[model samples]
Target chain A: MTAQAVISASDLSLTFTTADGPVFALQDINLTVKDGDFVSLIGPSGCGKTTLLRVIADLERASAGTVSVNGMAPEQARKARAYGYVFQAPALYPWRTVEQNVGLPLEIMGTADAAARVKRNLDLVNLGGFEKKFPWQLSGGMQQRVSIARALAVEPKLLLMDEPFGALDEIVRDKLNQQLLELWAATKKTVVFVTHSIPEAVFLSTRIVVMSPRPGRIIDVIETNLPRDRTLDIRETGAFLKIAQRVREGLKAGHSYED
Target chain B: MPVTVVCLAILVAWYIAAVFMNTVVAEAKIEAAGGGLVNTLDISWSLERPVIPAPHQVVVEVWKTVFTVAPWKVKSLVFHVWVTLSSTLLGFALGTLLGIGLAVAIVHSKLLNKSLMPWIIASQTIPILAIAPMVIVVLGSVGLTGIFPKSIISMYLCFFPVTIGMVKGLTSPDPMQLDLMRTYNASGPQVLWKLRFPAAMPFLFTSLKIAIAIALTGAIVGELPTGAQAGIGSRMLAGSYYGQTIQIWAALVAASAVAASLVYGVGGIERVVNARMGVRA
Candidate 1:
């Protein structure tokens, strides 16, 4: 994988105005995600990992500091449709069938003949025949798969996922995570994933950025030295366990905020 | 299966009781003899009056009005029904357009919501019946008679529920879904057309059903004044003048059936649109 930075954040901060007072969701955050890198942001609840993802996606504005994707402002990058975002929940439009939902971004981008792209993405996610189904008709895992297909259908340069599998059970999440990695490897797109699960972070990411709460900030960024040819069997190997253990310690440390 | 059957059975029983009452009145008329004038205690009737007519009497009158008599004639129920239906349809179309436009505006702008919502709710506070005659007189003076006055009444009655339902539906997207749209850099119009508008379909159709019913009511109410040329409401007024109770009741039933058919038609269209859009149910 290339080492060129696809996303860069410089001293980012965000504060939301609430009824009680101004709440600082994030502070002085600086990070870089390299092209073709699978990076995971692991943090405690309310630690602003999702907020950071939103900022990068241009879904939310930063209170201070600057962020750029592909050497352009977030807004410009968004307008150019440079990235796809998967939310914590599937967030599929209930009224749309899976195929139509997957084709939505293409429709918005005014792309021609989106049917083939939609089918290809569905195949990538192994959701080929379920295109005619509604969101409510599908199980949680299947719904998330449809969402992933929707994000991939646009063929974005970067994929920003905010706890995309957070709502699923462990078994379903693990299967989706493996499928996601496979898809990512095939596509070779930059991915910035958010998760609270240590094992999930270790299993999916090339690097895990551990974060702390209460004025959310990244505590450490650990590079995983494991081979990139990850398979289900590799997950059971000693290297996976060692990486997972390291992520767990980092999470614990960040959670306690002792250092 | 359970409650529906029981409710239908109860309705049948009530209908039987009404038939029995009519029969009793008929029997009393028979006992009083066929004199030019007959009296049973304080109740009195002339020989010209037939016994309390059966349900068949009303049906026969309805058939005669619909088939033998043209609508332009004074006795024709068909003429009055056509008038009422035209006004109802016109008003329903106008109201639906206004309601949808208002809903879109409110959904798209906070300023529109803050400024217009309260006034919209307040407008429905005034009873349409009380305002109908004034609307007729004002519109008639300006030579804007025929369907306009009646349609205005229908518009007033039909717009409230539609506006409310559409507003709720437009804003019903889950937060994450909205964020997803934002992430894609979808502009305001794009979000509205692709997301908000499609999402609001079921609600719009439901409100339309209700609006059509109210529009029919408005049309009928509109005919009370001005001695309309023809309409179900005009038929009722003429029937009342001649004490033709059965005629009045028949016209009412016809109006109700029209309303039901209109609502059903809109529902059918909604189903077709949803199915084409791949929305199940």
Candidate 2:
């Protein structure tokens, strides 16, 4: 039970045929994310980090491998409502109120307790009073928080976040990072996050999967020795620096100029 | 208001054009009777049969027909306006439904996108006025007289704007939003009703405004071929036959007012709907 894998991928590959040529978006992507583990996928722009997250969410299909979520196919897991995904943008429906945006998935699932779920999730993200506001009425950071609330409203076991705070200012990003870590602790959900920031990857992840571009593949999987009860200040420590250094090296080694 | 000032300017311009165009008849008569240049300057502003009716004369005629005459009477402008408006409204409703249906099909099906869109544009190229008599005659032959032929013509004019506007609007959502819908495992109808349709509100209203005006035009055009007894178009035709330029101008003014009101009606509904949806102007 302790070693249960929430997501497991073996030899997963995806190739996109564009007008230019067949672009190898992912190649030999093998990874295992355990239950309650905070895993971060860090890479450069074309590294397919978001693509990999999309594949797990069943938004994209892998060309060459088998990937399972909660012991079921990604598509089946999607249908069973096994995971909640937070996209890079807030992606809130402009016409709907914050409350309705949060309740969208519940409404789609025909869940009986949509109101309660919306309230709880909004409260979880410290957005309790803003439920009546539209997406445009809220600021960028607030809007993103609403999106997070929407993803959490379903109370799924697995949470997949694709750079959820990448669009925010540094202060808002730091605040959201702390809130996200608290949320992870409270729910103990298996979290899969994608990021480009070194400190962000190092600060939040229990396991870091460092990836590289050209026909994207994992270069290193670094297991952190830091304590579970960590804070943003932990990044200043020598141990945190050591892991960050290794991740930076892994990123550098994976970078190729010719491609 | 600025709109009033613009209208006043147009009236003044129309009055000047009327005096100029009517002088031709006065000059022709004077030349035939042996006095030309001297009486050309003495040409009457209010002629019995002016090429373009004087603004005040047209306004007086409009006032007489709208207020003095009984509203239900055949001679009253109100009766004619009602006839045209009813047909326009019927056609507008049918056209909106047809446009939405076709737009949804086009957005969802690649087959319709490839096949139907070109034909829609091509349909517009075939002048409606040229085909109006045929449409009226054919429909009349089939025993479908009065408002039905007029409404079909209105539907033809109104549906294009709605289809194009809705196509742009239905596909307005970015890839990110579509992906979000996919993640929710939303069905096609749910996606349409919840996302695509709501996103299309602004575009839909814009097209509806254009559609209403065109629908009114269609109704008027439909009336021309049938020698309709009722409706603004028939009034203009009767005025033309009797050389009553003032009556024609009055009918034109009344028809424009009807179009303005219909457009305003749609605007009112749009405001209420957008407000309910939490959309700002």
Candidate 3:
């Protein structure tokens, strides 16, 4: 509460006009994520969790209401390079090496001393020596890590991730989750993560926003009291279990309104 | 090694076809000259002139024209080749630039995509050879002669494949990848150069290989009706006028070699570029 809000959305809504009809993708979304907070948007498919994240990234337009990122409109914040976005897929250019892919934003933005920045970010993701390899040559999890490294290379204050680890196997996802927590702790960048996994939201977020499908709206917001210095082992703790239970209950309660 | 075998087999088949085709002309010559009707075996394998020259005779002519004559002289096959190659190269450069420019425009604007693409495609359906003579005449009236008219025809032929292929290439990036670029707040030109253009490379190169050969065909067609003093097309015309089958066959061989070399050169450059860019394919 002492920190200023980095992202604030109030009465935000988006409608997509398709051949069938106007689909209300997002409605009356009100949320506030403060500086250095890890907020996860957890919901089922077509729940508009990704859509909400996109509105913050300015990848999608909001039909109504006001939303701001780092005290500026999403579009303005985007133009100012205040945020880095990691897509669901790795989305690495096959033509570029790992280092080059990481350096893409810097190259586009005309940032100086890119080599040092790229090296540091690649190291942060524990992808230090794989700089010379192409995306296709690496495993899927490694490719996603490179994509994360790319996003972090810009040194943006806010990071927006859209199901970054959804495609990876369980073992790799667990390892990456641990690594991501460490990265977030070290950088202290405000993050808005979208995921369908309850455990993932519980394990990572400072606060979890549970959403419902069909004319998507936020159903509940749960704040975790887990320690900031927690590791993967903390998932077994009573405090972590309590938050997970709350998230599961919220999800179950969301289903009662499905019909 | 497999390529070598294929080439040898083609040569063997060509020699046999040449003998079969030339037998009719040889027998006709014997009959017209008041000699008794000649047997196929009795007809000479080598002749001063025949409907189809024997493979060895054409080879001899190629060797004589290429090596025996001074290359700088207009009579040499190399001189004609250089003339045709110059126009082909010039036209290819112009066409490639025009195609890329049009493709960029088409991909960016919905209006252009709908209006320009179909018309560009329809233009190809009206054959290049059919248009070459009219193009030559029109340009001649304006005092544009020799290589200029030929290169124009070459440009016409070269532009189509590049335009179509490049359009496909520029739009090849998946929606997710495109969204990533949008997230960066990249400008239109920035997205083009950094993302679309590089992604379009494999497609562009593949199209360029096809365009180069078509450009050569256009150059040859341009020279065909004009009866230019230089170029392989003129050489073929001269050979046809004098019933010199050997000379025509030699010129055809020269043109094929030029087309093959141009395509091979582009492929070589593609390999080097792809390797540098870390594209395994």
Steric clashes per prediction: 2, 0, 0
Taking chain A of candidate 2, what TM-score results?
Answer: 0.98
State how far residue B271 of model 2 sits from its true place (Å). Answer: 1.7
In model 1, state the lDDT of residue A232: 68
Which model, 1 or 2, shows the larger DockQ? 2
Query: How far in Å is the alpha carbon of B265 misplaced in model 1?
Result: 2.2
| Candidate 3 positional error at B231, Å | 0.7
lDDT (10s digit) by residue, model 2, range A1-259:
6779999999999999999999999999899999999999999999999999999999999999999999999999998889999999999999899999999999999999999999999999999999889999998999999999999988899999999999999999998999999999998999999999999989999999999988899999999967888898998999999999999999999999776
Task: Please give, as one word, the docking class of candidate 1.
Answer: medium
Candidate 2 deviant stretches above 4 angstroms:
B27-43
By DockQ, the candidates rank as: 2, 3, 1
Clashing residue pairs for model 1:
B80-B231, B80-B232
Write model 3 residue lDDT over A1-259, tens digit each, in one string: 5999999999999999999999999999999999999999998888899999989988888999999998999999998989999999999999999999999999988889999999999999998999899888999999999999999988998999999999999899999998999999999999999999988999999999999877889999998867888788888988888888988888787765635
lDDT of 2 by residue, B36-76 (tens): 54455345456777888777788899999999999999989
Cα lDDT, model 2, residue B226: 80
- Tens-digit per-residue lDDT, B1-281, candidate 3: 99999989988887677667776667676565565434443454578787777777888999998999999898799999999999999989989998999999999999999999889989899977789999999999999887888999999998999999999999999998898888888889989988999999999999999999999999999999877899999999999999888899999999999999999999999999999888867
For candidate 2, give the lDDT of residue B243.
Answer: 92
